[model samples]
Target: MSDPSRHPPTQAALGILFLILATAFFAVLDTSVKYVGAFVPVLMAVWFRYMFHAVVVTAVMLPLRGRSLLRTAHPRFQVLRGSLLLAVSAISFVALQYMPVGEFTAIVMITPLVVTLLAALFLRERVSALRWVLVTGGFAGALLVVQPGGNVIGWASLLPLVMVFTYAWFQILTSKMARTEDPMTMHFYTGWVGALLSSLVLPVVWKTIPDAGTFAILCLIGLMGTVGHFLLILAFKRTQASTLTPYLYGQIGFAMFCGWLVFGHVPGQLELIGIAMIVLCGATASWLTARDRRLPVEPPEA
Candidate 1:
């Protein structure tokens, strides 16, 4: 009977736990995308992922929110947001083709840095000097993680950097739109826009049709990925960003384990150090962002 809008204190505390669970399963989706990419064009793999996502979202929305899930006030903003997500997903799937999941994921941790900078430049938000310092440190950390030109596992490790930067811009847009939009409107558009956009060019890009087993794998990817984002959005709505930010590091472990178990991809010394720096920067930036958000709040009234 409790309104989810005013989440209980304990519910806020559980946000990170839910985020960690979502991240773990989400990592599996990423690994599966890479697995399918091996047998099909990355674009084709992305196409199927979104189609499955569309089917799942469409079916669920009918029973849950019905026509509300089909409504949104701002179509243009939704289009841009959906486009950004599709780009990030496509870039990431392509990047994973030759990159180890651990290395790809570590580079992705720096996306917060990119988001911080974008927030300052485009959204005109104030970012303290200390946060800038952390962002710079994060850049250096990413270089360490990639260790370019070395006899690394594969030079493709840096490809996810493309996704990170795109995602940074995407997050900034989301932040700006968050004030004007309801979460339901935002969520529905995400699935619908991305699915429709991909479906357009999918016929041109799709090379191989999936087998029955591979089709099932694609379905899993779609369901898990959509569920992961839904859980993430729910978690953030329930708690302070600072409260859940630190737990995203748990994603690294899950990503690495998936790589190890499924692909035998293990990190070498330099990559591990890079992962550490990425972790440090991620934690620091998250702490700073959270602290800033909480600073303007007045004490609760009696």
Candidate 2:
């Protein structure tokens, strides 16, 4: 990885651009998953996502990295990391089925706050008072988005909260493994682990495609996910994660746009305010985290 301190300002600018594009792609992936969920079993859709991602990544990366692409210093941790992500994806797919993309996204955006709580509790990390305030404020924002009596209320609303927890753990494990593992290798295992594990239950969830259009959309989901992560890797290579952290909130805006464009769904006033609060608090918390450690923070993949 190139040191962010050594990079020219133009490189950081390019990294920001890449990160924004990557977020857009993720928004598209979420929208596509929501659309396809209506026509297919959620499990089947999840399988296609990982299957396509695993195959495409293997095809492109194997030749470039050779057997080294499959090498890993911590095989068990890699599997555990991949399983956590699969849980995240499964929760996301099911949650999107019951909730609007924009609101669901805002709730999942509380991941950094959850990560902070987990680190302080389980990792024995010290938490400053200000960081605790940011974490509380971030969750408060999430409550505004999923407030009682809203359309998203009921058991469905808890789905994204569950996703936030699962994804936070995923981010934590990735940060630990990144210290010694090749990122590309970890990426490879993640895809295959998700694909292979999901495949075990595919026999029951398998269903005939209703049409070519549905099939195409499935392919689009895979393409968006694979390309989005690839761009993220490229972006981090060009600039420091702290330099790019603020821009990560761009996904919330993109998700709102996608929800409105596809479903004519717009967030209510409180929901919008809630979303803004999440963006503000989450970004500030990330900045503080990077500042305290003086190391590149591993970003949330969702």
Candidate 2 worst ten-residue window by lDDT: 293-302
Alpha-carbon runs more than 4 Å astray in model 2: 294-302
**CA deviation > 4 Å runs, candidate 1:** 1-6, 151-158, 294-302
lDDT of model 1 at position 157: 58
Residue 198 of candidate 1: its Cα lDDT?
85
Candidate with the greatest TM-score versus the true structure: 2
lDDT of 2 by residue, 23-57 (tens): 89989989888999989898888898899889999
Q: List lDDT for all candidates, in order.
A: 0.74, 0.86
Candidate 2 local Cα displacement, residue 278, angstroms: 0.7
Question: What are the TM-scores, per candidate, against the unseen true structure?
Answer: 0.88, 0.97
lDDT of 1 by residue, 15-67 (tens): 76678877887788888987877666777767766776667767766688877
